[model samples]
Target: MTTMDLHSMTGAYALHALPDDERAAFERHLAGCASCAQEVAEFAATAARLALASSAPARPEMRERVLHRIGTVRQVPPSAAPLERVRRGAARGRGAARWALAACVAAATAFGGTAVWQYERAQDARHDAARAERQAEQVAGVLAAPDARTRSVRVAGGAGTLVVSAGRDRAVFMASGMPEPPSGKVYQLWFDDGGTMRSAGLMDPGRSTQTVLMRGAVDGASGVGITVEPAGGSRRPTTAPIALLGMPA
Candidate 1:
C-alpha cells in the first residue's frame, strides 16, 4: 500500500475499527512514522473526550426502555441451519452500529481539534505578555537609578547616547539624528566589559530615535559601542563601530 493509504487508515486504527489483522499491521507502521503517530494520538484524545461526554447519567425512562427491550429480545444459536436469515439480519445490525460510531468519532475529532488550537493561542498570548512585563520592569529599574549616567557619542551621520544605571549592571541605548543603514544591514549594540566585548542588542535602523534595552549586563563594562552588522546582528563586532562612548567612573 502507498504511504497515503496507510496514513488514511490512522482514524480507523485510532478508533479500533480496523480488523484485527489490519490493526496489527498499522501498529507496526505507526512505530516508523512520526506523522502517523501524531495523528493517531490526536484521534485517541478526541475519542477519550467523546467517552467523557457520553458518561452522563441516562434518563429513568430511557433506562427502563432499554431494560424492557433486553428482556423481550430472543437469542438464536448461529449453528441452527434454519436461522440463516437471522444471521444476515445480525450482520446488517452490526453495519449500522459501525456507521453510527464513525459519525460520533468524526464529530468528537472536530471539537477536540478546535479545543487544542484555542489552548495553543492562549499559551502564546501569555508568553508575550510575560515577556513585555519583564522588559518594562527592567526599563523602570534603570530609569530609577539614583546615579544613572548618560554619555553622548557622535555617529557618521547622527548621534547616540548610552544610559547606564548607578549599579552599572543594566543599561539602555538611545539613538537620535541617525539615518537608517543600507539594505541587508542593521545597527547592533555592544558592551565593552573591562577588555571583553559582549552583544547588548539590536537597534532599528529605520528609527531616528530608537531606544533599546541592553541584553548583556554592564556592571563592570568600561564603555558601550554601536556597530553596523548584517541583518539579525552578529555575535561579535564584524565592522567598524559607528559610535563609542566611555562610562563615567
Candidate 2:
C-alpha cells in the first residue's frame, strides 16, 4: 500500500473498523512506521474518550430519534473537482493537512465535553445510591436491635406500630390500612419526650403499609403520636392525635 493509504487507515485501525486482512497488514506496517504508530495512539485516545461519553444512559426516545435520523439523512460523496482542488492546495503549502488536523481537534473537543458530562452524572448516581443505602441500614439497625421495644396504636381508620431502641436512640414507625388524607392535608409523626412533643416528619398515607425511620430522638421519648395536619406539616400539632402509644414501663 502507498504511504498515504497506510496513514489514512490509522483512524480506522484505531477504531477497529478495518477488515481482518487490512488490520493485519496495518499492524505489520505499524511495527516499522513511527509516524503512523503515533497517529494511531492519538486516535485510540480520542476513541476511548468517545466511548466513555456514550456509556451514559440515554433518554427513552433517543434510540428512536437516532434511528430515524440515520434512515433519513443522505450521505454525500466528495466530488473529484473539490478533491483535486484540495490536493493542489496541499501541494502548495499543506493546507489540506491543516484542515484534516483541525477537523480531528474539533471532534476531540466534542468528545471531551460529553465525557465530562457523563462523568458528573455517574457521580450523582453514586451519591444517591449511597444515601439510600445508609438510610436502609439505619432502619435495619432499629428493627434488629435486641433491646428494642414495640407497641401498636389504633387510629380512626387504621393501625400503626412504633419500635424504639433506647440503646441506639432510634425509632421506626410503621402504619397499616391507612387511607389517603384529604386534599391539602398530611399525617405527621411526633415523639413525646416527657410532655414535650418533637416533629418526626410527614408520612406517606397512600401506602397500605409504610415504614419509616423516625427523625427525632427516641432515647427519652415517653411515647409516639400521629396527628393530621396541613400539607408540609406544622411546628405544633394542629389537630388531636389520630393515635398514641405509651412506651413500655
Compare the candidates by lDDT and give the number of the best one: 2
Number of the predicted model whose TM-score against the real structure is largest: 1
Q: What's each prediction's clash count?
A: 0, 0
lDDT of 1: 0.75
| Residue 209 error, candidate 1, Å | 3.3
lDDT digits (tens) for residues 42-68 of candidate 1: 766566566544567878899889989
TM-score of each: 0.61, 0.52
lDDT per residue for candidate 2 within 101-161, as digits (tens), equals 7887777666665544434433343455556567789989988999888888776678788
Off by over 4 Å in 1: 1-90, 205-208
The 0-to-1 C-alpha lDDT of every candidate, in the order given, reads 0.75, 0.76
Stretches of model 2 off by over 4 angstroms after superposition: 1-122
CA RMSD of each candidate after superposition: 14.4, 20.8
